[model samples]
Target: MNENAESLSRRLIRNFNTAPTTHDVREPLYDSIGARLAPGTAAQKLGASIDTVAPGKMSCPYHFHYAQEEMFIILEGSGTLRVAGEMLPLRSGDVVFIPPGPEYPHQIVNTSDQPLKYLSVSTREQPEVCEYPDSGKFLAMASAGGERVFDVVQRRSNDLDYWDGEP
Candidate 1:
Protein backbone atom coordinates (compact mmCIF):
# COMPACT_ATOMS: atom_id res chain seq x y z
CA MET A 1 0.00 0.00 0.00
CA ASN A 2 1.03 3.63 -0.46
CA GLU A 3 2.16 5.85 2.41
CA ASN A 4 -0.99 7.99 2.28
CA ALA A 5 -3.20 4.92 2.33
CA GLU A 6 -1.30 3.53 5.29
CA SER A 7 -1.62 6.76 7.18
CA LEU A 8 -5.31 7.09 6.40
CA SER A 9 -6.28 3.64 7.54
CA ARG A 10 -8.89 3.42 10.27
CA ARG A 11 -9.69 0.48 12.51
CA LEU A 12 -12.46 1.93 14.62
CA ILE A 13 -14.94 4.75 14.93
CA ARG A 14 -16.00 4.82 18.56
CA ASN A 15 -18.91 7.19 18.36
CA PHE A 16 -21.24 7.72 15.43
CA ASN A 17 -23.05 10.52 17.24
CA THR A 18 -19.92 12.63 17.29
CA ALA A 19 -20.02 12.91 13.51
CA PRO A 20 -22.56 15.74 13.69
CA THR A 21 -25.75 16.23 11.69
CA THR A 22 -26.39 17.76 8.29
CA HIS A 23 -29.56 18.52 6.38
CA ASP A 24 -31.14 20.95 3.99
CA VAL A 25 -33.59 23.47 5.41
CA ARG A 26 -35.52 23.44 2.16
CA GLU A 27 -36.32 19.78 2.68
CA PRO A 28 -37.96 20.45 6.09
CA LEU A 29 -40.27 17.47 6.51
CA TYR A 30 -38.03 15.12 4.57
CA ASP A 31 -34.84 16.06 6.37
CA SER A 32 -32.20 13.52 7.35
CA ILE A 33 -28.52 13.69 8.26
CA GLY A 34 -25.48 11.50 7.73
CA ALA A 35 -21.79 11.22 8.43
CA ARG A 36 -19.55 9.89 5.69
CA LEU A 37 -17.18 7.47 7.38
CA ALA A 38 -15.31 5.57 4.67
CA PRO A 39 -14.46 8.32 2.20
CA GLY A 40 -12.03 9.88 4.67
CA THR A 41 -10.34 6.51 5.01
CA ALA A 42 -9.66 6.41 1.27
CA ALA A 43 -11.87 3.40 0.69
CA GLN A 44 -11.63 2.54 -2.98
CA LYS A 45 -14.29 -0.05 -3.77
CA LEU A 46 -17.02 0.86 -1.30
CA GLY A 47 -18.36 3.91 0.53
CA ALA A 48 -20.13 4.12 3.87
CA SER A 49 -22.12 6.66 5.86
CA ILE A 50 -23.98 6.68 9.12
CA ASP A 51 -27.40 8.23 8.66
CA THR A 52 -30.03 9.35 11.15
CA VAL A 53 -33.60 10.37 10.51
CA ALA A 54 -36.04 11.97 12.90
CA PRO A 55 -39.49 10.56 13.50
CA GLY A 56 -41.95 11.02 10.62
CA LYS A 57 -39.17 12.00 8.24
CA MET A 58 -37.86 10.26 5.16
CA SER A 59 -34.24 9.54 4.31
CA CYS A 60 -34.68 10.25 0.62
CA PRO A 61 -36.97 10.16 -2.33
CA TYR A 62 -37.94 6.88 -3.93
CA HIS A 63 -35.23 6.23 -6.50
CA PHE A 64 -33.28 3.45 -8.14
CA HIS A 65 -29.66 3.48 -9.32
CA TYR A 66 -28.38 2.42 -12.71
CA ALA A 67 -24.79 1.53 -11.85
CA GLN A 68 -24.37 1.55 -8.09
CA GLU A 69 -25.64 -0.94 -5.50
CA GLU A 70 -26.44 -0.16 -1.87
CA MET A 71 -26.95 -1.88 1.47
CA PHE A 72 -27.92 -0.58 4.88
CA ILE A 73 -27.47 -1.95 8.37
CA ILE A 74 -29.92 -0.57 10.88
CA LEU A 75 -28.19 0.28 14.15
CA GLU A 76 -31.06 1.61 16.22
CA GLY A 77 -34.71 2.71 16.30
CA SER A 78 -37.49 1.76 13.89
CA GLY A 79 -38.66 2.77 10.46
CA THR A 80 -40.42 1.67 7.32
CA LEU A 81 -38.80 0.65 4.04
CA ARG A 82 -40.70 1.58 0.93
CA VAL A 83 -39.52 -0.15 -2.22
CA ALA A 84 -41.31 -0.54 -5.51
CA GLY A 85 -44.55 0.44 -3.78
CA GLU A 86 -44.15 -2.05 -0.99
CA MET A 87 -44.01 -0.99 2.65
CA LEU A 88 -42.07 -2.99 5.22
CA PRO A 89 -41.23 -2.37 8.85
CA LEU A 90 -37.61 -1.98 9.94
CA ARG A 91 -35.87 -2.14 13.27
CA SER A 92 -32.47 -2.49 14.85
CA GLY A 93 -30.20 -5.14 13.29
CA ASP A 94 -32.12 -5.12 10.01
CA VAL A 95 -30.10 -5.32 6.82
CA VAL A 96 -31.49 -3.82 3.63
CA PHE A 97 -30.00 -4.61 0.25
CA ILE A 98 -30.73 -2.77 -2.97
CA PRO A 99 -29.34 -3.81 -6.31
CA PRO A 100 -29.18 -1.91 -9.58
CA GLY A 101 -32.52 -1.88 -11.40
CA PRO A 102 -35.46 0.33 -12.31
CA GLU A 103 -37.87 -1.96 -10.50
CA TYR A 104 -36.60 -1.22 -7.01
CA PRO A 105 -37.06 2.43 -6.22
CA HIS A 106 -36.60 2.69 -2.46
CA GLN A 107 -36.73 5.05 0.51
CA ILE A 108 -36.76 4.91 4.30
CA VAL A 109 -39.18 6.64 6.66
CA ASN A 110 -38.78 6.90 10.40
CA THR A 111 -41.97 5.63 12.03
CA SER A 112 -41.21 5.48 15.73
CA ASP A 113 -40.89 8.37 18.12
CA GLN A 114 -37.11 7.95 18.38
CA PRO A 115 -34.49 8.72 15.79
CA LEU A 116 -33.67 5.99 13.31
CA LYS A 117 -29.98 5.27 12.70
CA TYR A 118 -28.43 3.13 10.03
CA LEU A 119 -25.10 2.52 8.37
CA SER A 120 -25.37 2.86 4.60
CA VAL A 121 -22.86 1.09 2.39
CA SER A 122 -22.64 1.29 -1.39
CA THR A 123 -20.43 0.46 -4.35
CA ARG A 124 -18.22 3.38 -5.42
CA GLU A 125 -18.97 3.48 -9.11
CA GLN A 126 -18.73 6.77 -11.01
CA PRO A 127 -20.93 8.24 -13.70
CA GLU A 128 -24.04 6.86 -12.06
CA VAL A 129 -27.53 7.40 -13.38
CA CYS A 130 -30.59 7.29 -11.17
CA GLU A 131 -34.30 7.46 -11.79
CA TYR A 132 -37.14 8.57 -9.56
CA PRO A 133 -39.94 6.18 -10.39
CA ASP A 134 -42.70 8.15 -8.77
CA SER A 135 -41.65 11.58 -10.02
CA GLY A 136 -40.58 10.67 -13.57
CA LYS A 137 -37.26 12.41 -13.06
CA PHE A 138 -33.70 11.18 -13.62
CA LEU A 139 -30.29 12.08 -12.26
CA ALA A 140 -26.91 11.97 -13.98
CA MET A 141 -23.83 12.16 -11.84
CA ALA A 142 -20.06 12.10 -12.09
CA SER A 143 -17.89 12.19 -9.02
CA ALA A 144 -14.33 13.28 -8.31
CA GLY A 145 -12.67 13.37 -4.91
CA GLY A 146 -15.95 12.18 -3.38
CA GLU A 147 -17.82 15.22 -4.68
CA ARG A 148 -20.18 15.35 -7.61
CA VAL A 149 -18.57 17.38 -10.39
CA PHE A 150 -21.53 16.95 -12.73
CA ASP A 151 -25.00 16.43 -11.35
CA VAL A 152 -28.05 16.93 -13.53
CA VAL A 153 -31.72 16.23 -13.00
CA GLN A 154 -34.16 16.05 -15.87
CA ARG A 155 -37.34 14.53 -17.15
CA ARG A 156 -37.39 11.76 -19.74
CA SER A 157 -38.85 14.08 -22.35
CA ASN A 158 -35.84 16.37 -22.07
CA ASP A 159 -33.61 13.86 -23.89
CA LEU A 160 -32.10 15.36 -27.02
CA ASP A 161 -31.37 13.66 -30.29
CA TYR A 162 -28.09 11.74 -30.24
CA TRP A 163 -27.03 13.25 -33.61
CA ASP A 164 -27.93 16.80 -32.65
CA GLY A 165 -25.02 19.21 -33.20
CA GLU A 166 -22.94 16.48 -34.76
CA PRO A 167 -21.14 17.27 -37.99
Candidate 2:
Protein backbone atom coordinates (compact mmCIF):
# COMPACT_ATOMS: atom_id res chain seq x y z
CA MET A 1 0.00 0.00 0.00
CA ASN A 2 1.09 3.55 -0.60
CA GLU A 3 2.39 5.54 2.37
CA ASN A 4 -0.53 7.96 2.12
CA ALA A 5 -3.21 5.37 1.51
CA GLU A 6 -6.07 5.10 3.97
CA SER A 7 -5.82 2.49 6.70
CA LEU A 8 -7.58 -0.89 6.36
CA SER A 9 -10.30 -0.04 8.84
CA ARG A 10 -11.09 3.24 7.14
CA ARG A 11 -11.19 1.67 3.72
CA LEU A 12 -13.48 -1.14 4.77
CA ILE A 13 -16.07 1.13 6.30
CA ARG A 14 -18.37 3.29 4.21
CA ASN A 15 -21.51 5.28 4.88
CA PHE A 16 -23.79 5.32 1.91
CA ASN A 17 -26.04 8.15 2.98
CA THR A 18 -23.24 10.58 3.75
CA ALA A 19 -20.98 9.70 0.84
CA PRO A 20 -20.51 12.36 -1.81
CA THR A 21 -22.87 12.06 -4.74
CA THR A 22 -22.51 12.45 -8.48
CA HIS A 23 -25.40 13.68 -10.52
CA ASP A 24 -26.57 11.44 -13.33
CA VAL A 25 -29.29 12.97 -15.40
CA ARG A 26 -30.50 12.41 -18.93
CA GLU A 27 -33.42 14.38 -20.26
CA PRO A 28 -37.05 13.60 -19.46
CA LEU A 29 -37.11 11.08 -16.64
CA TYR A 30 -33.59 9.79 -16.00
CA ASP A 31 -32.13 11.61 -13.05
CA SER A 32 -30.35 10.48 -9.93
CA ILE A 33 -27.60 11.19 -7.47
CA GLY A 34 -25.11 8.36 -6.99
CA ALA A 35 -22.40 7.90 -4.42
CA ARG A 36 -19.89 5.23 -5.42
CA LEU A 37 -18.63 3.17 -2.49
CA ALA A 38 -16.10 0.70 -3.87
CA PRO A 39 -13.34 2.59 -5.65
CA GLY A 40 -10.79 2.98 -2.86
CA THR A 41 -11.81 -0.01 -0.82
CA ALA A 42 -10.05 -3.39 -0.55
CA ALA A 43 -12.85 -5.07 -2.41
CA GLN A 44 -11.49 -6.33 -5.72
CA LYS A 45 -14.38 -8.25 -7.28
CA LEU A 46 -17.41 -6.17 -6.42
CA GLY A 47 -18.73 -2.66 -6.89
CA ALA A 48 -21.26 -0.74 -4.85
CA SER A 49 -23.07 2.56 -4.89
CA ILE A 50 -25.82 4.51 -3.21
CA ASP A 51 -28.33 5.93 -5.62
CA THR A 52 -31.05 8.46 -4.90
CA VAL A 53 -33.76 9.12 -7.39
CA ALA A 54 -36.29 11.88 -7.14
CA PRO A 55 -39.97 11.21 -7.38
CA GLY A 56 -41.09 10.47 -10.95
CA LYS A 57 -37.54 9.78 -12.12
CA MET A 58 -35.44 6.76 -12.97
CA SER A 59 -31.81 6.24 -12.24
CA CYS A 60 -31.08 4.27 -15.34
CA PRO A 61 -32.65 2.64 -18.34
CA TYR A 62 -34.00 -0.89 -18.58
CA HIS A 63 -30.99 -3.00 -19.37
CA PHE A 64 -29.23 -6.22 -18.44
CA HIS A 65 -25.59 -7.27 -18.37
CA TYR A 66 -24.13 -10.38 -19.93
CA ALA A 67 -21.38 -10.91 -17.35
CA GLN A 68 -22.33 -9.29 -14.06
CA GLU A 69 -25.13 -9.79 -11.57
CA GLU A 70 -26.60 -7.09 -9.33
CA MET A 71 -28.62 -6.55 -6.18
CA PHE A 72 -30.37 -3.52 -4.76
CA ILE A 73 -31.52 -2.86 -1.24
CA ILE A 74 -34.03 -0.11 -0.89
CA LEU A 75 -33.00 2.23 1.88
CA GLU A 76 -35.67 4.91 1.74
CA GLY A 77 -39.00 5.88 0.17
CA SER A 78 -40.99 3.87 -2.34
CA GLY A 79 -40.92 3.20 -6.05
CA THR A 80 -41.89 0.90 -8.85
CA LEU A 81 -39.54 -1.70 -10.25
CA ARG A 82 -39.99 -2.43 -13.89
CA VAL A 83 -38.60 -5.88 -14.44
CA ALA A 84 -39.24 -8.20 -17.34
CA GLY A 85 -42.12 -5.98 -18.45
CA GLU A 86 -43.81 -6.12 -15.09
CA MET A 87 -44.09 -3.33 -12.54
CA LEU A 88 -43.42 -4.35 -8.94
CA PRO A 89 -43.81 -2.09 -5.95
CA LEU A 90 -40.70 -1.14 -4.02
CA ARG A 91 -40.43 0.25 -0.52
CA SER A 92 -37.87 0.77 2.15
CA GLY A 93 -36.25 -2.47 3.31
CA ASP A 94 -36.94 -4.22 0.04
CA VAL A 95 -34.15 -6.24 -1.45
CA VAL A 96 -34.11 -7.01 -5.15
CA PHE A 97 -31.83 -9.35 -7.02
CA ILE A 98 -31.28 -9.11 -10.74
CA PRO A 99 -29.47 -11.77 -12.72
CA PRO A 100 -27.65 -11.11 -15.90
CA GLY A 101 -29.19 -11.75 -19.35
CA PRO A 102 -32.06 -10.78 -21.61
CA GLU A 103 -34.80 -12.26 -19.46
CA TYR A 104 -34.24 -9.83 -16.64
CA PRO A 105 -34.09 -6.40 -18.18
CA HIS A 106 -34.95 -4.00 -15.36
CA GLN A 107 -35.24 -0.38 -14.22
CA ILE A 108 -36.46 1.43 -11.11
CA VAL A 109 -38.80 4.39 -11.20
CA ASN A 110 -39.51 6.61 -8.22
CA THR A 111 -43.28 6.76 -8.27
CA SER A 112 -43.84 8.02 -4.74
CA ASP A 113 -43.83 11.64 -3.62
CA GLN A 114 -40.50 11.37 -1.85
CA PRO A 115 -36.99 10.68 -3.04
CA LEU A 116 -36.13 6.99 -3.35
CA LYS A 117 -32.80 5.68 -2.20
CA TYR A 118 -31.14 2.32 -2.64
CA LEU A 119 -27.83 0.62 -2.24
CA SER A 120 -26.73 -1.19 -5.37
CA VAL A 121 -24.07 -3.87 -5.47
CA SER A 122 -22.77 -5.81 -8.43
CA THR A 123 -19.93 -8.02 -9.57
CA ARG A 124 -17.03 -6.21 -11.15
CA GLU A 125 -16.70 -8.12 -14.38
CA GLN A 126 -14.56 -6.77 -17.20
CA PRO A 127 -15.19 -6.82 -20.89
CA GLU A 128 -18.87 -6.90 -20.19
CA VAL A 129 -21.71 -6.58 -22.64
CA CYS A 130 -25.04 -5.03 -21.68
CA GLU A 131 -28.18 -4.99 -23.74
CA TYR A 132 -30.91 -2.38 -23.64
CA PRO A 133 -33.96 -4.23 -24.79
CA ASP A 134 -36.36 -1.31 -24.79
CA SER A 135 -34.26 0.66 -27.28
CA GLY A 136 -32.77 -2.20 -29.29
CA LYS A 137 -29.31 -1.08 -28.24
CA PHE A 138 -26.28 -2.75 -26.70
CA LEU A 139 -23.12 -1.66 -24.97
CA ALA A 140 -19.73 -3.39 -24.98
CA MET A 141 -17.13 -2.29 -22.47
CA ALA A 142 -13.65 -3.39 -21.53
CA SER A 143 -11.43 -1.94 -18.85
CA ALA A 144 -7.80 -2.43 -17.87
CA GLY A 145 -6.26 -1.54 -14.54
CA GLY A 146 -9.46 0.19 -13.46
CA GLU A 147 -9.45 2.34 -16.57
CA ARG A 148 -11.80 1.99 -19.48
CA VAL A 149 -10.13 0.68 -22.61
CA PHE A 150 -13.03 0.33 -25.02
CA ASP A 151 -16.64 1.37 -24.67
CA VAL A 152 -19.29 1.51 -27.32
CA VAL A 153 -23.07 1.52 -27.47
CA GLN A 154 -24.91 0.76 -30.64
CA ARG A 155 -28.15 -0.52 -31.99
CA ARG A 156 -28.50 -4.14 -33.09
CA SER A 157 -29.39 -3.03 -36.58
CA ASN A 158 -25.89 -1.63 -36.96
CA ASP A 159 -24.20 -5.00 -36.63
CA LEU A 160 -22.27 -6.38 -39.58
CA ASP A 161 -21.31 -9.88 -40.66
CA TYR A 162 -18.25 -11.42 -39.05
CA TRP A 163 -16.44 -11.60 -42.38
CA ASP A 164 -17.55 -8.24 -43.65
CA GLY A 165 -14.70 -6.13 -45.01
CA GLU A 166 -12.21 -8.92 -44.22
CA PRO A 167 -9.59 -9.90 -46.77
Candidate 3:
Protein backbone atom coordinates (compact mmCIF):
# COMPACT_ATOMS: atom_id res chain seq x y z
CA MET A 1 0.00 0.00 0.00
CA ASN A 2 1.28 3.44 -0.92
CA GLU A 3 1.92 5.84 1.95
CA ASN A 4 -0.78 8.25 0.74
CA ALA A 5 -3.07 5.58 -0.71
CA GLU A 6 -6.05 6.23 1.57
CA SER A 7 -5.84 9.97 1.49
CA LEU A 8 -5.40 10.10 -2.27
CA SER A 9 -7.82 7.33 -3.15
CA ARG A 10 -11.58 7.60 -3.40
CA ARG A 11 -13.74 5.52 -1.15
CA LEU A 12 -17.17 5.18 0.35
CA ILE A 13 -18.20 4.82 3.98
CA ARG A 14 -21.37 2.82 4.33
CA ASN A 15 -21.46 3.73 7.97
CA PHE A 16 -20.58 7.19 9.23
CA ASN A 17 -20.18 5.62 12.64
CA THR A 18 -16.67 7.04 13.16
CA ALA A 19 -13.90 9.05 11.63
CA PRO A 20 -10.47 8.17 10.29
CA THR A 21 -8.87 9.46 13.49
CA THR A 22 -10.54 9.11 16.86
CA HIS A 23 -9.38 10.44 20.25
CA ASP A 24 -10.66 10.95 23.75
CA VAL A 25 -11.05 14.41 25.23
CA ARG A 26 -11.07 13.70 28.91
CA GLU A 27 -11.10 17.27 30.20
CA PRO A 28 -14.34 17.83 28.34
CA LEU A 29 -15.21 14.15 28.49
CA TYR A 30 -15.99 13.54 24.83
CA ASP A 31 -14.81 11.58 21.82
CA SER A 32 -13.53 13.39 18.75
CA ILE A 33 -12.77 11.98 15.33
CA GLY A 34 -12.24 13.48 11.93
CA ALA A 35 -10.74 12.92 8.50
CA ARG A 36 -9.18 15.53 6.27
CA LEU A 37 -11.49 14.24 3.60
CA ALA A 38 -10.86 16.99 1.07
CA PRO A 39 -7.21 17.80 1.65
CA GLY A 40 -6.14 15.43 -1.08
CA THR A 41 -9.36 15.68 -3.02
CA ALA A 42 -10.61 18.26 -5.48
CA ALA A 43 -12.46 20.16 -2.80
CA GLN A 44 -9.37 21.43 -1.02
CA LYS A 45 -11.16 24.52 0.16
CA LEU A 46 -13.56 22.57 2.35
CA GLY A 47 -13.12 20.17 5.27
CA ALA A 48 -15.37 17.81 7.20
CA SER A 49 -15.39 16.02 10.55
CA ILE A 50 -17.57 13.87 12.77
CA ASP A 51 -17.76 14.41 16.53
CA THR A 52 -19.52 12.48 19.26
CA VAL A 53 -19.95 14.26 22.58
CA ALA A 54 -20.63 12.28 25.70
CA PRO A 55 -23.70 13.10 27.69
CA GLY A 56 -23.28 16.45 29.51
CA LYS A 57 -20.29 17.36 27.40
CA MET A 58 -19.58 20.13 24.96
CA SER A 59 -17.67 20.23 21.70
CA CYS A 60 -16.06 23.56 22.44
CA PRO A 61 -16.51 26.87 24.12
CA TYR A 62 -18.82 29.49 22.73
CA HIS A 63 -16.70 31.07 20.05
CA PHE A 64 -16.79 32.84 16.69
CA HIS A 65 -14.47 32.98 13.75
CA TYR A 66 -13.02 36.00 12.00
CA ALA A 67 -12.53 34.43 8.60
CA GLN A 68 -13.79 30.87 8.27
CA GLU A 69 -17.39 29.74 8.47
CA GLU A 70 -18.84 26.45 9.71
CA MET A 71 -21.95 24.35 9.22
CA PHE A 72 -23.00 21.40 11.33
CA ILE A 73 -25.53 18.66 10.73
CA ILE A 74 -26.76 16.81 13.76
CA LEU A 75 -26.56 13.12 12.91
CA GLU A 76 -27.98 11.56 16.08
CA GLY A 77 -28.95 12.15 19.70
CA SER A 78 -29.83 15.58 21.05
CA GLY A 79 -28.12 18.68 22.39
CA THR A 80 -28.41 22.43 22.90
CA LEU A 81 -26.77 25.19 20.95
CA ARG A 82 -25.39 28.23 22.69
CA VAL A 83 -25.48 30.98 20.14
CA ALA A 84 -24.67 34.56 20.93
CA GLY A 85 -25.90 34.14 24.48
CA GLU A 86 -29.02 32.18 23.51
CA MET A 87 -29.67 28.50 24.15
CA LEU A 88 -31.34 26.60 21.33
CA PRO A 89 -32.42 22.98 21.39
CA LEU A 90 -30.69 20.67 18.93
CA ARG A 91 -31.61 17.19 17.73
CA SER A 92 -31.03 14.68 15.00
CA GLY A 93 -31.29 16.10 11.47
CA ASP A 94 -30.85 19.68 12.60
CA VAL A 95 -28.51 21.81 10.54
CA VAL A 96 -26.61 24.79 11.92
CA PHE A 97 -24.90 27.59 10.08
CA ILE A 98 -22.22 29.72 11.69
CA PRO A 99 -20.83 32.50 9.62
CA PRO A 100 -17.71 34.53 10.33
CA GLY A 101 -18.25 37.36 12.79
CA PRO A 102 -18.29 38.16 16.48
CA GLU A 103 -22.05 37.90 16.61
CA TYR A 104 -22.03 34.28 15.53
CA PRO A 105 -20.29 32.78 18.55
CA HIS A 106 -21.67 29.31 19.16
CA GLN A 107 -21.18 26.03 21.04
CA ILE A 108 -22.85 22.64 21.15
CA VAL A 109 -23.91 21.23 24.51
CA ASN A 110 -25.06 17.66 24.92
CA THR A 111 -28.27 18.16 26.82
CA SER A 112 -29.48 14.58 26.58
CA ASP A 113 -28.44 11.45 28.46
CA GLN A 114 -27.12 9.86 25.26
CA PRO A 115 -24.16 10.72 23.13
CA LEU A 116 -24.55 13.54 20.64
CA LYS A 117 -23.22 13.05 17.15
CA TYR A 118 -22.77 15.67 14.46
CA LEU A 119 -20.97 16.29 11.20
CA SER A 120 -19.21 19.63 10.92
CA VAL A 121 -17.98 21.27 7.74
CA SER A 122 -15.92 24.43 7.53
CA THR A 123 -14.02 26.54 5.07
CA ARG A 124 -10.21 26.36 5.08
CA GLU A 125 -9.65 30.05 5.47
CA GLN A 126 -6.15 31.04 6.53
CA PRO A 127 -5.01 33.81 8.86
CA GLU A 128 -8.07 33.20 11.00
CA VAL A 129 -8.92 34.40 14.46
CA CYS A 130 -11.28 32.85 16.99
CA GLU A 131 -12.85 34.65 19.91
CA TYR A 132 -13.84 32.76 23.03
CA PRO A 133 -16.63 34.57 24.81
CA ASP A 134 -16.78 32.80 28.15
CA SER A 135 -13.02 32.91 28.67
CA GLY A 136 -12.54 36.39 27.29
CA LYS A 137 -9.73 35.25 25.02
CA PHE A 138 -8.80 35.57 21.40
CA LEU A 139 -6.91 33.00 19.35
CA ALA A 140 -5.27 34.33 16.25
CA MET A 141 -3.26 32.76 13.47
CA ALA A 142 -1.75 35.25 11.09
CA SER A 143 0.21 33.99 8.12
CA ALA A 144 0.91 37.35 6.47
CA GLY A 145 -2.34 37.11 4.50
CA GLY A 146 -2.27 33.34 3.88
CA GLU A 147 1.46 32.78 3.62
CA ARG A 148 2.71 29.47 4.96
CA VAL A 149 4.66 31.25 7.69
CA PHE A 150 2.08 31.45 10.45
CA ASP A 151 2.25 33.36 13.74
CA VAL A 152 -0.19 32.18 16.36
CA VAL A 153 -1.12 34.69 19.06
CA GLN A 154 -3.48 34.44 21.97
CA ARG A 155 -4.59 37.32 24.17
CA ARG A 156 -7.20 38.09 26.73
CA SER A 157 -10.41 39.58 25.38
CA ASN A 158 -9.95 42.59 27.63
CA ASP A 159 -6.29 43.06 26.82
CA LEU A 160 -4.59 46.31 25.87
CA ASP A 161 -5.82 48.65 23.16
CA TYR A 162 -4.80 48.41 19.51
CA TRP A 163 -2.26 51.18 20.03
CA ASP A 164 -0.83 49.80 23.24
CA GLY A 165 2.26 48.42 21.54
CA GLU A 166 2.66 51.25 19.03
CA PRO A 167 5.57 53.69 19.30
Error of 2 at 27 (Å): 2.5
Model 3 vs. true fold: TM? 0.76
What would the TM-score be for candidate 1 when compared with the true structure?
0.86
lDDT of 1 by residue, 1-167 (tens): 68755564453332466765576333666867888776456467788888889888887888999999999999999999998899999999999999988878899989889999899999978989999987899999999987779999999988899999899
Off by over 4 Å in 2: 1-6
- Candidate 1: C-alpha RMSD to true structure equals 3.3
Give the higher-lDDT candidate: 1 or 2: 2
Using TM-score as the measure, the top candidate is: 2
Cα RMSD (Å) per model? 3.3, 2.4, 4.4
Look at candidate 2 and tell me the lDDT of residue 165. Answer: 100
Off by over 4 Å in 3: 1-18, 26-36, 142-153, 157-167
**Against the hidden reference, what TM-scores do the models get?**
0.86, 0.92, 0.76
Better of 2 and 3 by lDDT: 2
Best by lDDT: 2
The residue ranges of model 1 lying beyond 4 angstroms of the native Cα positions read: 1-15, 25-28
Which of the two, 2 or 3, has more TM-score?
2
Clashing residue pairs in candidate 2 are: none
Give the per-residue lDDT digits (tens) of candidate 2, residues 83-126: 99999999999999998888899999999989999999999898
Question: lDDT of all the models against the reference?
Answer: 0.85, 0.92, 0.76
